[model samples]
Target: MSEAPLAARPPAQQDPLPAAWPDHLRALPALIEAAGLVSFDFFDTLFIRPLADAEDAFDILGESRGIADFRARRRAAQAGAFRVMQQEKRGEIDLDGIYRCFDGLPDAAAVRDAEYALEQEITLPNPEMIAVFRAALAQGKPVVVTSDMYLRAPWFTALMRRHGLPEVPLFISADRDCTKRDFGALFDLLSAETGVPKERILHIGDNAASDIGKARERGLVAFHYREPRLPPRCKGISPAASLARALIRNHQQEVPPGSLRELGFQKGGPAALGFLDWIAGAARRDGIEHILFVSRDGHILRRMAEQVRPEALPPSSYLLGSRVAFTLAAMTPANFESHLPFLLSGADGLSPAELLARIDVPAPGASVLRDLGLGPETRFRHDQPEPMRGLLKAWRWEILKIARRNRRGLLRHLLELGLRPGQRVALVDVGWNGTTQEAFVAALRGLMPLDVTGYYFCLADSEDARRRRALMPMESLVGPDSVSPGMLAAIHANRVAAEFFFSAPHDPVIGYRDDAGGVVAVEDPGRAPTDGIQAMARELEEGMLDFARHHTGWTRRLGLRADPLGLAMPLLEEMADGSWADHSGLRLVRNFDSWASSANHTMWLTDYAARP
Candidate 1:
């Protein structure tokens, strides 16, 4: 076919080119119009396989052919063949040449046929470039294809025709025994055979060195069709990770500006928006009237919700409260004994007055401590003595008094929100055992009648959470069920980073108090320090927002809303697993919680590298 001049042949009638070209081929039309003849590089330039990489096709071949070792053998043989070809300076090797490298393999013909079948199954025409080819034909410009592949010219032409390309002159390195990579021999051969002036031919392909560089050396115009380049760290990973990286790259390419996908690139952006999206849907489904975001994790969540879907979601407010404050405010004499261990867990090495100060309760006077048979300088430990327990038991009434006073302050705060009795109000929070919600319910028991539901990103399957029928758990991509326990632990280890990212700039809630005027929330003294934590938090927030903005439109167009949970799982899993190497740079935070008294006394989260 190459013996005849492509320019001498008549152009074939074809359908008009697509009005909108794919991103990579947008420049092809102009390049084609400028040249009298155009040549396309086959393989990636005009076709792309859906597989993660080209060699993945061999794996499919091995599975289909029932030859478990075929893929490995094929790779070894190809590497050996390429070494021989490079040594010989022949520039290329055909299928037979490659097969000859595997001298010990039985039934070479069968193996070759299996590979051909696999290629047929995996090869797909790149529509964007095909449109460019068709456009060249319509514009009466002669066209041909040149490839560096080891496949024979006939097989290449046949595959092209099967994929809807019109028959045209073809030049392959294997058939010619010379490559475009060596001295531009293939281009010289094409010019000699097709009788087309090298200066008048334009070559368009993905490889800069072989196609563009070689063609340009031969005085032909070259258009580089750029493809996404994965970072060096992303390549050569496990297949699952490689595939994940490819999927991420594809998502980035398809994502529109200001969509969820774009926003998600910001740290903590996707999780925040995803949780809010789930909350909005839940509120709509359950007929919730008011949404209260529990501080301080809910602080950022509320802000994100307002920015992303203000109109679609119900009215929301940031309620100033936390687990520690609410748990203390809701304590009663009846439950005080059962909760004593938890309340005093963080009070190790503290004196009676200091211990009382920690919970923001008034410390009993020295005379009262002495009367209760306790010294002012007495220290508390994880395992309290019987005397200390008795002393705690005696102080229950005072604790209850303080709890009731704080409860009144909480009730007054809620009343100011103007929520009607029996209204369905949903409390939003970052998940765990739902202790804050439980405390809130206990505090408001007789003060007000309201149907309150707790909505969280994930609800821990703890005894406390199991009994709460009013708690609504939103399935998260990075929860226990979605990932292995080890992975879940890894995420928990990063809680400090997560919390820092999700937290607002304001101080933490201490407790509430009531005066003659009204209820007031007491906040911590100063802002959380700005350090590496803040930098990481900013990254997470920006990443999530960017991903949300970028991918939201694509998600809608692709009908991804049908299984939003499934769609979100992989991305979340990758992030949770720290699959991307860039995630290694995330600041590792060490969190020490004295409240946890399990056998594994010091819980480790984040800093997987530093884990003992």
Candidate 2:
């Protein structure tokens, strides 16, 4: 049965044409108006192979034949065949002639069949060029297709027909044993066969030598169809996608909505993947066997790490502890005196109940409150330190009791995770002052002898963080050298948003307590407020994963890997500067006192304002 006509098939998706055409193609209308006929060059002009590189089709063909080194062998054979053709000044070689270069190959016929099948799978008509063909035909202009490929004329006609193009007169190099590259020979043959005037015959194609240079030399009006160049250092899937992007942009058209989303994800996802890879590599290098991702902020990072490099990374777990939880749990009589500064710094005008809530502890019993000469109505003000000091002295004993219990519970939880003495462990968090690490180490001292290190995304240049880094080895993926001042401010101002994005679907870790089973983290029954923020976070998270998957595949194909720091720094900067996406109206209502106490107060209030 005959195939359906091009007009009878379903209309393909239409992409907007570019506003301007190349200088060569710009003369097409006048040439068509004056000419008796117009001819098109196949391959890159009329049809684009779905593969990134045409040679990749051979790789697929080899794989189908179960040849382990098919790609290398195919490359060598093609090179040899082309060299012979070049030496003899011949047009082209058929599949049989090319395969002759591989003398040791078994069942050459099977390989030929595989090549045909792969071609059929990867070949796709260029929709924009096809539209041009349709328009020319509508204008009563006769058109034909001429190609320098090894495929037979009948095969080329059939392929075009299958892709919903008119079955125009077809010419192939192998069929006539002469190519357009051989100067005037092919054009002379075409003109004699079609009875068209040489000057009036306009030919459009992608190759500069065989299509434009040679066609013009033979007196045919030639238009050069330039293919978009792939980005530098791009390989595998990236090259193909990047080329497509160029084509879309050159057309002065927007990409499809789905493609836009995919590209956005690609920008961010690779960074996350790169960072995870870096962390895994660092852990291995340092002989760190356990990775403890701190609660809330570490939640999404841990998930990304598991997805990207599950087997390559060391064992990981989410340790449910926050700055508030750890700091409060680490407090005691000896340290309470020192921590009084931090605790009371932002305590001005706070009621006794409110102050206790900030400390992650329940209000003391009525009898304890009475003994401290304080009631629920009493406010802790920084201006009057005497009464607050008296109350702290009275509450010191009870506070110590609570801290000791929590510290023991924390130790038990560590033991449950199989944390052993002298083992190296790394604590991961979105860093500020490294308070969580210090609090954790202080709680663990004399309780366990494990050596601990801290890995942060970025560390604030603060005295406390510096002191902690001096005593305990610490590293940051994003630091002063990597982030700009504005970007750092945006990041600092959006801590709540970051926490919401990274946190698990659970409540904050209030404290830890021993149970019949063992040490268990105590959590609030209510879930974090995530109605609006959840959707945004999920969109970003999904985009990151998708990009990572594509980037990782490309890296693997090219036998090279991307640097995590290089990938992560730019992404973080974009996100921080609000240049990534419009985050208007997204408010982080919760106030973080970390900003007030730290030296990094350059954060802009506009960053916190609702987007218009």
Candidate 3:
């Protein structure tokens, strides 16, 4: 049956013409009141798939389970199914039909199940269109869903009810085995079922061609609700109901929200929540009693925990520490060789005087290096270790003597900062090989004989990690080598981005000294960070804290737990792929020196692309 030839009623006299694009959705309620019947497109109208595209669900289903190039394969399967359906004169292909045409049918059923789950996960209620849906019902107009979608009636109705959408008649093209392309056959069926003429019906949807043009073809007044543009890094992954959205919406309510704050709220905050949740769970599983948030990366993390510690999480302390601080304080005549690499890491192209200063070798002790046939101005690179190592070794004792004195002061500082003899502690940082943990352990050798576990954001999976794994327990929140490897690898290649995210607003802790008999941080008198970086840092900090506060309230309200990691994966994937290089806040992260390597921040995205 085809729609009867009819002329659509003009828009309501009380309501002005609907605005263009995004504003059209908001103006839809007035149009609904003008009609005897209101038709809504199922997807991207009443609800949305908060993914890059409708097909992105297939990629998520396949990639999340480590199926390589699953999206490409899934796309091929769907195209093949469509071709088969065309030959058979079939309607929109259902999920099962697409899978039946799938290559490697052995895994088809499993992947299909995953596809259903991912669809369920990514689906979101379009709040503005939902308002239109409510208005239609409120006007006593007959409301119905008309769509050319694969999802059948039962599941579609189920989804509507699940999201609090009122029960109404649905006219699905797939159910009738006729699509919108069938010249209003689907709309005629809707008119027949609802007993409302096509001319008096008002339709609202996202697609201009399928929803607007087709409804107009059916003599129904159509309103186009165009999707809004997402933020720079948020493209392809911004879920409408996510914490990132919540933060963005909240920030927009403020007088003005900067990109820096939005970055933390949308990207860093969710990532941090995911990592923190993982860390807390791991710590509890390992029976850890106390967690140490090692400086300077842990500053924001520590504050987040303080603001929102999940129920019964282990006690935490913001431990004042760094690789150079712990390594220099722990180094002795016997272990100076082992600590030498960290000392000379960024010291390659400088004179002995500059190198001595870089390595934290004190004034008088560094002067002892001149006696070993190497003047204060002698240039030696650590990479060519043969001559430089020999010269450094010739006077290692004197340099270490000064280092040993600092070690005593550090022990006192650590004690004052709350390290004890036998505490079951864990060291936390934005991770890689657990070098800080190793140095921290060595620093406490005489003072605490403590065997502390290391909890990193991502373990480097290197020789150092393997060696340290034998010495003490270790766990990583993110896996570059294992779980979520693709996303994590993108994250790894852009590790500089993570450093940029967690950059702090304070000078780094260089060393410790006695202050009125109590140990205090002996920070450098000239504490210089990249100019303008701290403004971004403070904004990121505020945004992250804001997320933590809201996250606590939301999880508590929902009762059924939301996946923090799931919220983070989308933003992180963009980061891994270098999409965040455009963020203005990240650009301020210059000369970011971490893990003893210094480089321009956010430049790694280009550098990584050039590799191989």
Each model's lDDT comes to: 0.64, 0.64, 0.65
**Candidate 2 accuracy as lDDT:** 0.64
- Report the Cα lDDT for residue 290, model 2: 92
Ten-residue stretch with the least lDDT total in model 2: 594-603
**lDDT at 593 for candidate 2?**
30
lDDT, candidate 3, 1-612, per-residue tens: 233222233322332322441443566656766788888887866777534356645544554567767777878888988998899987677778888988775667877876665666556666656655665555556677788877677767667668765667777876787777557677767777667778877877777787878778988788887655333333343222243444443234331344677677767887777777777878878888888888778888888887787463687888776776787788887777886666566554455544555444543345556555566555666657555566557658767765776687777765766667787888888877777888888788776776599888776645777788788788776664445656655666667667666656765665666678676654431212345656767888787777767765645533324454565564566566787776655655653453332221222223332111
Whose lDDT is greatest here? 3
Greater TM-score among 1 and 2 belongs to 2
lDDT of the structure predicted as candidate 1: 0.64
lDDT tens string, model 1, 1-612? 443346534454655576786666677767777887889898876776543567756655565566677778998898899999889977788887788898687888888876776576556666556767778887888888898887888777668768767777888898888888877899999888878889978998888899989889988889998754322232232222222233333343343333322334533554565667677788898899999898877866776667656776787888887776677666777678777775666555556765555456667788888887778778766675565666667777776776776777777788787777788898887766666777777766677877888887655444665666445333333455655666565555434445544665555676788877877776543211323433444555555555555445433432233222333344445445554223434324322221321222323333332231
In model 2, where do residues sit more than 4 Å from their true spots?
A: 1-7, 10-268, 345-350, 364-394, 481-501, 524-543, 575-581, 585-612
Which pairs of residues collide in candidate 3?
A: 490-576
RMSD of 3: 9.0
Q: What would the per-residue lDDT of candidate 2 be over residues 241-352, giving only the tens digit for each residue?
A: 3322222222222222233233335344544555566678789889998999887667667877777667867888888777656766777777788876756666665655
TM agreement with the true structure for every prediction? 0.53, 0.57, 0.63
Q: Which model, 1 or 3, shows the larger TM-score? A: 3
Query: Alpha carbon lDDT of residue 142, candidate 3?
Result: 64
Candidate 3 or 2, higher TM-score: 3
